[model samples]
Target: MRDVQWIYSHEVVARPQSQQPTARIPAPTSAMQTCGPLLFAACRRRGRPSPADAVCRCLVIHLSARHDGTARRGGSVAATTKPSRLAASPTLPRVPIPTRTRSRMHLHQLKPGEAASLPRHLLEAHVVALVRRCCPGLLALRAAHARLIRLRLPRLTAAFALSKLLASSSSCGAAPSYARNLFDQIPEPTAFCYNSLIRALSSAAGAAPAADTVLVYRRMLRAGSPLPNTFTLAFALKACSIVPALGEGRQLHSQAFRRGLEPSPYVQTGLLNLYAKCEEVALARTVFDGMVGDKNYAAWSAMIGGYSRVGMVNEALGLFREMQAADVNPDEVTMVSVISACAKAGALDLGRWVHAFIDRKGITVDLELSTALIDMYAKCGLIERAKGVFDAMAERDTKAWSAMIVGLAIHGLVEDALKLFSRMLELKVRPNNVTFIGVLSACAHSGLVNEGRRYWSTMQELGIKPSMENYGCMVDLFCRSSLLDEAYSFVTGMAIPPNSVIWRTLLVASKNSNRFDIVQSASKKLLELEPCNPENYVLLSNLYASNSQWDRVSYMRKKMKENNVNVVAGCSSIEINGYLHKFVVSDDSHPEIKEIRLLLREIADRVVRAGHKPWTAAVLHDVGEEEKEVALCEHSERHGSWLPALTGNATTMSTVGVYSTARQIFR
Candidate 1:
């Protein structure tokens, strides 16, 4: 696919006017657009790069069929181009800026706080310095820098004079006004000059700088300047990616194709990356298919990852396997995408296959892959297996330990998780913000109040700052233990603002304790934080029903309908001997419905005999609690579990439930 996109390049870029003798440009005008911006402007000037000793403007960018004239019509030139360290384009000319000095009267004429304004002389240097940080693709700057360039530069003085009026201090970053003034003097800028400006504008952070990159693209187009090279397009694409300007991206890509740039690996990669981010993986694949060769790894990875993220795991795996067959060895990024695909497919057997492959191929298992595997095993109901992998790791980062701890906590092994956390401390593996979340979760899952307090105080003792999630977890732990006022005081005295998740956790804990006022408060806050979340409304209605307020419950239900909130469907999933079966409440969609019903009936009788009562509040949400117990006994996982028990050697086997939480086990 990559090979197909290459354009015939027999000395493609034309030499600048100041160089190769046969040059007749017919002056700059709209007619220049016929030839495209990169070439036309790139063709215009043939001179030494600015600061002749340094290669300031030797760059060539390609856009493919993705980024449009956001540099022109749409107002952006940013693409999130996957940066690669490669030599700069040889044919491109270097920037050769002239010296200039700012007059004292110009300094007097300058507006207050206008120092950062750019000067033409320093424009090439200042922009190079600034953009190299945000986007490092511009290799020309590797040799030159701002402070190294002339400090009393003429362009700097000119920009300084212009900044006295046209610009403000904040507009120029650390660039001086003289550099800003240089921009006006060089009315007929070489592509190097334009590249510098594009680099600076394209790199401006956030939406504001994003908008500026587009304006610059447009200005170049209006000037009948040649389109930017693939490198320039890549930078602009980064901005478009940030703001998600698809139309602008598409236009730039088309312009790139027109400029005969479809073959460049950089352009194709950026196109695929941008398209994937927009949830356009199909389009990204189309771009990937046109890549020239192994040069398009970024493009392939982007498309594969986009598919994997959206749950098209089979397709992602297929592409990766195909890449392998083609001998395109997977890099760390490629492995990350494939590992994610394995997780999404719930393919634990396949995960083992990958692990074996990594071992046989001598591929180092990175922290990311290890973490994904931990999550995969946990989700697959293989907690022991997950632990084995976690313990055997050569080295572990905070996230790796956090993933293992969280996996254990979620699987009803809180003590084991905490024990591993203790090991982490003994090994001097410092915990980050995420470590607290895992620890707090362990406490919540195990109903360990005293242990939670001790660990929490120790957290402060260790100088760890508790984030909002930590606070929520602690509140839920306390509330679940029926420590109502303690939970209340903890939440009210939170150091950070609580979000809806925190409120919802508090509300659920309050519900278990029958704390009506706290429930009301938490629900109110949840509503404010998540106004569109219907669960809060439904839960509040359910809470009123719990207290026997049928009228209030009915009113809440009416409001639900008025606001278009629907009850979330209940779902249960069970993993049995490597196969997962899902059961939705009241759903009879499985193949062996008759057998499932029989197993569920038998489980209900046994659960009741074992003292599992019908749910109370739900029974009167209009039935008797007795009838509700019948309903509880038939809960989805219990039903799903029965099918597994029926298939296994029932009397000899203990049902091991793979749950997202310990409460699920109790349920």
Candidate 2:
């Protein structure tokens, strides 16, 4: 050091852009400055300054990239300089790492080939293990695991301790860390360690697992340990899937495959489960398609469920047929998926065929299967068949009752749904969130303001925390019932957080009930939530126009244009026979264009002769009175009617169905 020369920033006029110095540059100091420009130019001219530039650049790189633990944005090197309290201390290093732990952390703990190779999440999990142990139950388990990690400790003692902790309080916090001295002692894990963790994960199925699971996985991966059996993969896959760690799951899948675990039915199903949760449907299907023989019931069910959720009902039903042709048995899930496909496609005939198949198989109507059947029939216009299914059931769950209630509500049987709701409560099967949504919708449809209000209050009394959907239901319910003040108060005073759906529901409700005073505020919030949702923009403008706020209407319309929120053209469709014939409100695009025009004239003439006035307020257009009236009468449902007509379908009863709401109205 006495023979060596150290240059400070000011002493070095400049430095060349190069890599590290062979010797020390300068010690950390309170004040720091950049090298002079002249020195930089001179250093560039000679290889003499390469070492200095290297050392300087290396110091900056170290500070910016890793020294302070602030992960640098990729590709760009940044230097962070801050004052250290060590500058004033006599014995401490001038550069200090920010840390809060009272005990010293050995640097060798993060040495090469140590647990540092573990995934970042697992490393964080290890950090959590260091902090738990303030509670008595967890304290006991921590001591037991520590003892088990040591020599001469009976495995059963640790097992019993972990079991007692899980059984006593399902909500124990983080795990207790093993001792620092135990790092060098890589003893083989006994059977007890694996068994305890798995049992605890199974018992805590309702909740997510503690991060200890990840830590153990990391340790296993680092050691090239033998793979866990089918049950372990199944459980671990579920835990990983719940956290939605796509990368970790993919790694686990690779390990499973490497260990020849691919064909295991449970493992494959677990793979599908994980993929479906990740919304990687293609992967899930690929795994399902690779099954060697007739798949197990759970495997088939997982595939059907995956397709059903991804809106591929046709494929789901097709797979069901494929399974059936292979002599595989169909269960409630398969039946439910088939019925749901029928409802989505509006295939009433196919739905009836499924019902017959279910009967032939002697499949009894459980609550879920029965509920799906009821919904399929109701949606496909076979209300009578749906009611029959409801009546045939030996027993009903709250969902079954809600299904019927909702079907009746959709068909304008509000009183009927209410009666069934009362029956559900009397049966002592507690109603869930979906059940309340259905019943409240009934109140919305029937304009039962008092009944809807009472139900909203009763939800909290029943100890059910109202969700965002529940509040959306209440807002739309009040809005439909013309209880503007009540709907407004409910949304504004919600204890739980309000969501975009709640705001949008209030906005739409305002338009219907003519509550224009607060429409602007609701519309503003709606735009904030869904700035790119074109419907909200058009609907808000329509709301202003309906309430006679013509000036604000013009401003909103102009703003909507300025923001490029072009309204999608409103096309109406009617289902006639077996076809859907689409008709634009203003343009003629149907193959049956001539007939649609002629029918429109007939409907208009009949309207005038019958003395039924056209309510132009409901029309979502900025046209003149005559044009708006014509648009109102030529809705999509009117065109949909031509669909049935073209397909040789006929309506015996003169019922009118509104296109916008998707509900039929009997005249």
Candidate 3:
């Protein structure tokens, strides 16, 4: 469709000016209406008083004469064969007569100030025509911009024209420096000029950052003229959202409210989004609840998204239900937030229902929505379903591919994840940092040390810096493969200081590998990094006890008591239907706690009968073996792991897998 439109526009440009009707353009038909403005602009471009202006002046006079029947009676007027003004300027193509119908507007109707405005508008239209010939490129725009400046149009005219140039340049993906320089030349910019510049900067790459846009808005305010309108407020809020400036955004919200602009859905939605991105969910909800009359999907979606972004899944879900109750049909944005909440809460059933709703309602599955769906399915432990969603996507972006890869990697489909990564590279889909994290994590988990190194090198070669996650993956890969010394060296060799997680990973792996040298060093570093984290002391004590260093174990326990440190008890949750039920270690808060405990005991007995002895070393307390086994049974993860089987819902398998991983970590 775009190609066809481009061809039509090009055909208008391709027609030579000489080939236009040589006969005097008759009667003010729709096709001839814009000739006056186009000719006037062209004449000005060829110098202030060129012969082209003389010719156009004569043509308009002749047309008026003919219209009033002052010319030869019943006779047609003909253009003279004399050398034409356009003949000297073959480069200026005849302005295509716009085919679209327009309301009657003439140069005569415009006031003195607006007389300059018409020529500038027509000039921009001509420039737009030229830009089409060299579009998706900046050269024509650069030339047009230069010509406009040289013309020295009136101040207001120039600002308007420069604004158009800036917009065109940005739309063509040109370097914004030219536009920025052009904007700086405007002596006193109007509201249109500021709005255009702000909008362009908001969307441009590597241009002024969002913070700069807010500064520009502040400058506009300081100008004290050209008070901001709806457009200005919308763009300003967008800039605030991008920079995530909660204070400035809230201030703007108040200003807009005082100005009575909150009634405008555009301002309302923009303000809601600003609060959402800033993670001020409560304020966003206040804005949402304050909205009067019929609410749009965007306003509701923004509020729900605010909740989802801050990991308040229940609130997001509740809002989704309220939105439905209000008969505000959910759009793609709403669904994305709701699905994300499901992913966070591990609500596979609700996520699936939303997915089906999308299909049933025939909602457009854009890249973002599709990516969210993949993430939801993968995180829900329906990895194959996630892969299916991924494969079926007609247009997959980096996020889509990364979600699938990460999902597969976490679910222990290591080889499958790597294969997809290879395929992604083969298809020339440039992998991002997230993609590398997934691939490297897959390698680390599968003990593909050499493979992990190769990917790390590939990432560097691709100019992708290894982030903390990447470093963690490498350390984990070494540690998992029992290369404690190498892991320690890698940690030391890191360009940035290792976080406690890195040191902790090494400490746990060292104890497993019986590397006392690394265990002591890593534990000391962990304690220093997180002085009050009870896990560090507990881990050190466990290592000492494992090696029968009873005195050192006793000393570590004493230090933990002196510091008043307490371990954060493990907890797990499983989502049934749409509600999440969480269990804490030795939890007795649930009304069904007795039944759950009995069920866990029964499962533990069945496990023993199946010749699967519980790994009890994770119980750090010095207790009898039977007591340690009892402690393992009372663990929250052990109880949560039975939800899928007892509830007869296989969809909660992801919860079980999570429990297994946690159990393995302790083991």
Please tell me which predicted candidate would have the highest TM-score against the true structure. 3
Please provide, for model 3 over 1-667, each residue's C-alpha lDDT reduced to its tens digit, 9 standing for 90 to 100: 5744443333334566776546544555544444655555554444444443444544454444435432211111122222243332333223323311110122112233443545555544543454454455677777766665555557656666666776676567665466577678777777887887777676655424466677777788899988888888898788778767777777778878887888777887888899899898877887788777788898888888889898777788888888889988888888999999888767777788889989998888899999999998887778889988888999888999899999999888998999999999999998899998899899988899999999999999999888898899999999989888888999999999999999999988988877878877888888889989877887778778877778898898788789988777777666666676677876698665677678878888999999998888777777899998888778776566665566677563444433222442111
- How well is each residue in 580-601 modelled by candidate 2, as lDDT tens digits? 3455656666677767667777
Instruction: Give the TM-score comparing model 1 with the true structure, all chains together.
Output: 0.60
Each candidate's lDDT (Cα)? 0.62, 0.62, 0.73
Off by over 4 Å in 1: 1-224, 239-272, 275-300, 307-329, 341-347, 378-384, 408-430, 443-466, 574-582, 586-589, 593-595, 602-635, 642-667
* TM-score for all models, in order of appearance: 0.60, 0.61, 0.73
Q: Candidate 2's error at 375, in angstroms?
A: 2.8
Worst 10 residues of 2 by lDDT: 73-82
* C-alpha RMSD of candidate 1: 17.3
> Candidate 3 overall Cα lDDT vs. reference?
0.73
Q: Over the stretch 508-538, how does candidate 1's per-residue lDDT look in tens digits?
A: 8777877779988888788778766777776
Q: Residue 510's C-alpha lDDT in candidate 2?
A: 75
- The TM-score of candidate 2 is 0.61
